[model samples]
Target: MVSIRSVHGSAQLLLDVTGGVTDIVEKMHRTIAREVNPLNRLRDMTGETPVAKQGHTYRIIQSTTSLLKQGLHRSLDGLSAQEEWELSPQSLKITAALNGVCGDHLEASGNPLAISMHLRNSRGEKLQPGSTSLSTMIPDASPRIAVLVHGLCLSHEYWKGHNEGNLGTELQSAHGFTPLYLNYNTGRHISRNGRELSQQLQRLIETWPVEVEELTLIGHSMGGLVIRSACWYAGELDLPWTSRLKNAVYLGSPHHGAALAKAGHLLTSVMRQFRYASPFALVRHTSAGIKDLRHGNLLDDDWAGVDQDDFHPDYRKPVPLHEGTRHYFIAAAIGKQVWDLPSTMLGDLLVRLDSARGQHSDDLKKLSICAEDCRVFEKLNHLDLLDNKVVHEQILGWLA
Candidate 1:
């Protein structure tokens, strides 16, 4: 057996194997190398791009700035203020004006980018930051469930209940799709999260006394990436649920890669020039995914520098999507005001038309409805789409 010394998530791994210790060390070193380098060439856009890499970067930055304002919202939590929610018409409009200014960054200067998600985590709770494995409450009879894996900094709680009904609960009750929320640390490599999601899903499938026949998934923002992580994990596990997966819906999911992630990647390098940040920043720049420009949960996920897997375009490039049983892409587009109306798509004010649309997704048949006939609730923001009355209905309708 070979012993390879590694430091990932505070675990000192002495992996016992058939090979001798020297061989293990060499393999481990190679893994580290792959883990460290993703884009040999930075700004490596596809052969067919609507604009230049720098142009994409500029657009992405503008879109990112728009979303950043929402992140910066004086969040009592990721919801409108309680008192504000109860305001009279006049006060409501006033508060809206105030929030509008604060929220304007996402709308005006473009969107700010992040790579992580924020959900309230309690001590000792299984749903830790970057957590991949969770055991659901084993109801007497197996219940159909859909697992929601968020993209970047957002966590399970990202799907909040609006008007006594949240996205998860709504999916289960309205459509018999039980909701299993997964929260993983976004700072880790995509492949690490992918593997972890596989393990966790495997555990979920094996534990179910009765088979869960139909399964669906919805991912928002980077959470879309997390869903892919889980699905890729499913492929690795060869679990029944992987194929049992009936449909997948992505709202503002960046199937390829987000220019903002690249932007944040660059910003981290700049931040480093001055001083340290959030302790986690020191190790962030080691890899492109690790740098986590948007909504980062640096404290969670054990899969950072330690995991030795290459980053795939399914991890980076948005379009030319990988095939799936029933892969559905629902982009939240934020367009500029035209002659008489606002942009038909209003993504959470974070992700924009191009990024969310996965313009470059792999060679899957790009549907015209891909952008036009989508279930559009034009006034709603990105996150709002998950719980927005019409949006949830739209998700349910899509499954139908």
Candidate 2:
């Protein structure tokens, strides 16, 4: 049976999309008619085109909007929150994808699907991890916490693959470390999410049923940047949780910056140079979180007042790893041979080898991971890091 909640949610999304499209079209039409269309401008100057006709177009748009609201409201009139069904994996995936693309906007606009930072159980239910709620949530939770942060456009559920096992589960069975999955909005600025994560970790550790002896963070891609950002904030605030942090592992993380986002920004810039293509360039108006990844931004000041569509030189401050924490990095490449430049350049498809390894031309921006602590795997893409057997073994070895 189709869910009323889904129906209502779909209708609301449709209305929002329609409204945005309508506004864009109206603006484009006005611009083209006034400036691009010489014939219309000539007609206006010659008094051949009636101003009233243009006014009619706006009136029709207003009337259509009113009708759309009425129809959507009527369709959702009998729907109640109780009628909502549990979110399927597919539905959750779609929601996560949307959040990754426009999460900052959705959050600013107060969209219902905008995900908040939460610790989730294996079944994907949120756990408070507070003293009062920890027992009811996870009765046998271990004091050694291993937190897993997923990449952009993904949810905690993504950690559980189809056939191959994820690192978190494997580590749980091999070692007695308890795994906590984080579900958060990936569209917000990395620093914003980082600060929130820092605070949340403090709360989580302090409220643990037992003393947190060790806290290890395993982050993939952008999740690594968030972890790093959180670490900086944790130091600034002098949180007690910082003392408990033991190991920090980054898998396929673009510690320097991803080339793909830079290339996309170039394309958007080219499109914005012309009048007609300018509106199309709006397609690149992704969330601030994604834009930050372009230069591996780990601080709020990195993006202060920067235009979303324009390319800016790297303005990030150097964020080194915590001195007390052990850092491990793993990068993947699709090339069969490790020496292949093509595959090496396309590190894990989304990150570059040098970037993932935290190499930088700017001396200040270079990270402190030792050469021995880093590993690179050939014949693997970015997502493969989650389930690859060899990668799993390497992680187990590192944790051990």
Candidate 3:
């Protein structure tokens, strides 16, 4: 069931998006036209002057633009009187996908999916730390707190709806730990998100009704990098929350680098090698968050003064696990064991085993987790690391 408001908002977004995309295509078309020289090649045969041909092309472009605008306007005018119905889950999924890809853009443009920290209750109502709101949100705030941070393109609701036993519920039932969720725009740089998270965590702690005892952080994918960034920022700023950190857990975190991002970088490099493909290379001009994953950047200085499109060798400053907090890591493989070649190569279909394990040739860049502290769950992909039974058991054992 789609609401009129959602439909109208999406229509507006589509119109703006179409304009942006067309601008790029128009530029590319001009470049192609110049290279092809189709008009010049056929000028004599067509018996047309260069000026006339140019006028014709301009008219065609204008007509197409007008038609597109008219079509969008007509669609907007065609909405039915019935405003509510049972909406398909697919529509929400599509909206979430759009947000994940260009959430930073949406936020910049003040669009519908601009994300924020929404500490939502079981009924999907937002919670606040004010006295009245706190009582309603958390009837019994526990001393121990486990904050679950979702990965790229995900909302905090992901943890709640995952097929496995809800992580927050499990921790609460087994260890008397209260759970907090963080929802954020993943399209921003990890360092940027990290700085904000550091401040937010401090506020959350300061506002807690009970005396904060122990704090544990759990992050997945890009969320892991964000946690690491937050820890570094907190330490640099001398924030009090870092002092209470008891443990940090990373699930399928690409501590070194993600191969997919590297591959995308390589593709962009190759595309830009040709003059014709140069403009189209803008296709790879993704958000800062995706770019930071190239070398697992965790500090503000890591990307200072570097042009977003320029490719540089990975020489990022090393950011280790928080010294005072015990760190645990869970890596996943799609095979029976770690030695399986395909599993090692694919590494749960996103992060490689070595990268997830924070194993690097340079000891300076390597994360210092003992072999016994790391576990590899088999027959699971990256997303499965979120809800798999074996992975959940490992998390339980580590927390215990």
lDDT of 3 by residue, 1-400 (tens): 4476466557657766666666566657656655678564456356465534654665576567657656754665455233442233455445545666676676675554455554554444556654467755787789998888888777666777567678777888888888887777888788988998898888778888889999999999988999999999998888989989999999999898888877787788888888678777863657777887888888878888886566788768988788889899998888888898878788988899999999999999999998878998888888887777677778888898
What would the TM-scores of all predictions be?
Answer: 0.52, 0.90, 0.85
Ranking by lDDT: 2, 3, 1
Clashes of each: 56, 0, 3
Instruction: Point out where model 2 deviates above 4 Å.
Output: 1-5, 35-85
Candidate with more favorable, higher TM-score: 1 or 3: 3
Question: Across residues 1-400, which tens digit of lDDT does each residue of candidate 1 receive?
Answer: 1111101100211111112233334434433433466442232344232223344554465455445434444332233222222223343233223222222222232222111122221221233322333333333323566777665544454466445357776666677765666655554555555566666666666555567787676777666666665665565466556766777777876544454554555555564453223222323324323333232211123234432222212222222233545666665444433111334333435655544554433444232234433443455556666666766777777776
- Write down the lDDT of every candidate, Cα atoms only: 0.46, 0.82, 0.77
Query: Model 3 Cα RMSD, Å?
Result: 5.0
Give model 2's clash tally. Answer: 0
The candidate, 2 or 3, that scores higher on lDDT is 2
- Best-first order by TM-score: 2, 3, 1
TM-score of 3: 0.85
Top candidate (lDDT):
2
